[model samples]
Target: MTRSVRRTRRILQVTGVSAAALLALSACSSSDSDSSASASASGKLSGDVTVFAAASLKESFTTLGKEFEKQHPGTKVTFSFGGSDSLAASITGGAPADVFASASPKTMKIVTDAKDNATEPATFVRNQLEIATLPGNPDKVASLKDLTNSDLKVVLCDRTVPCGAAAQKALDASKLKLTPVSYEEDVKSALNKVVLKEADAAVVYKTDVKAAGEKVEGVEFPESADAVNDYPITLLKESKNPETAKAFMALVQSAEGQKVLNESGFLNP
Candidate 1:
């Protein structure tokens, strides 16, 4: 072959190789783009986030869960609502949970002490003890001192729960000793006793009384100021969905969260 012909052939060979390389690069780029698009379009955050909260928070949390679902379209929020101390025990026993919101810092300490806490908990709300009485206040049980009256049938939360602890503090502060006929496991049950007229009065959370609405009347007492309880919330260290848990925490700490809590009669922390 002539030298010019040979040079032209070499040039053609180089052009063909360049075209092949360009085609390979384009194919790789397209594959990556498609993968990313598929991942983005799936619209599913697949994981279970178990939340343990105090029983008094049942109604408020049910509302908040719906709101959270609205905010995070595909996320699932599973709640285990009960007495804070009982929930604490469940968490300590290796029950899986992503978050915990306790009515008292003391109960939260149980998880924190076990090193199962994800981070430092924040006080989202505060609650004080209140006297939940019959609809018409028939007994006229007006004050903490009055609870000591032998004629009154008073009930209180179990000593292990926050409400019970606060009730004790209030009674101690007033230097009044009263014998409650029963010590319910949680605030709601104690309040229920009054609602059902099983007891004449019960020392429960302000929020619980508000939740009960017209079923029972809440009478504020001066002694309640001495037993204000602080509620703390934290994410669990063993969470399978940390990102979603963090997002939920942000919502609880947000202005919107505060509005819901306040509307439900919880005091600002």
Candidate 2:
């Protein structure tokens, strides 16, 4: 071959190899850019997630909220804990909340029926009723039947509340009737009545008694099994921060969240 032809061929070969290298580099750069964009979109989470939860879940949910905030920096978890039915009413009435965790399915229905929930609620735990008595059992309250004594200053949650409804169910299940001295709006208030020594005993959740620590003594009865309440949680339809809300819900249903709840005396759903 001629020297000029050989030199031209050599240049053409180098040019082709360089073109191939450039194409490969460009493809890699494009792939990396797409991946980085995806990671940025899905991995970055930040905002305030307001949770409306039942009064009975205050302890466990608070711990989970703190854990959620810790896991995602630049995020805040604020909770409104109250009666489940009341909270449901607030949600349906256009309350700005990211999540709702109710103490019972019946109360959860209030929100679901109103189409205020973004997704169907899932039961996360179950709670049983327990008698909260004065420290050291001054009244010697032992069983559900013992609360029937007319002399006893017994406080109960209002029938509209989950705890109150559960208590009534247990009372009915045992075929016994007892009038309460007073009815409170929520489980916490009912339990507080006993803690403050205003009532000799209160029919509240086992979790409430556990949360009360040494302030009150918990008495469990067989009838509680018949009226165990199921706790359900869901995302609200009007949440402005849906992503953060969902992440918090995922944390609640995660193993780590369940551990906190189980430690707080909640039964697995």
Error of 2 at 227 (Å): 0.3
Tell me each candidate's TM-score.
Answer: 0.87, 0.86
Task: For residues 71-115, write the lDDT of model 2, one tens digit per residue.
Answer: 899999999999998999999988999999999999999998885
Off by over 4 Å in 1: 1-30, 33-46
Write one digit per residue (lDDT tens) for candidate 1, span 1-269: 89999999999999999999999999999999999999978755545578899988888888888798887777888899989999999998899889999999999999999964557899998988889999989988878888899998999999999999999999888888989999999988999899898999999988888999999998999989989999999998888888788778788878998889888888899
User: Which candidate should be chosen as best, given TM-score against the real structure?
Assistant: 1
Indicate the worst ten consecutive residues by lDDT in candidate 1.
40-49
Model 1, position 18: C-alpha lDDT score = 100
Q: Quote the RMSD, in angstroms, for model 1.
A: 4.1
| Candidate 1, residue 8: lDDT | 98
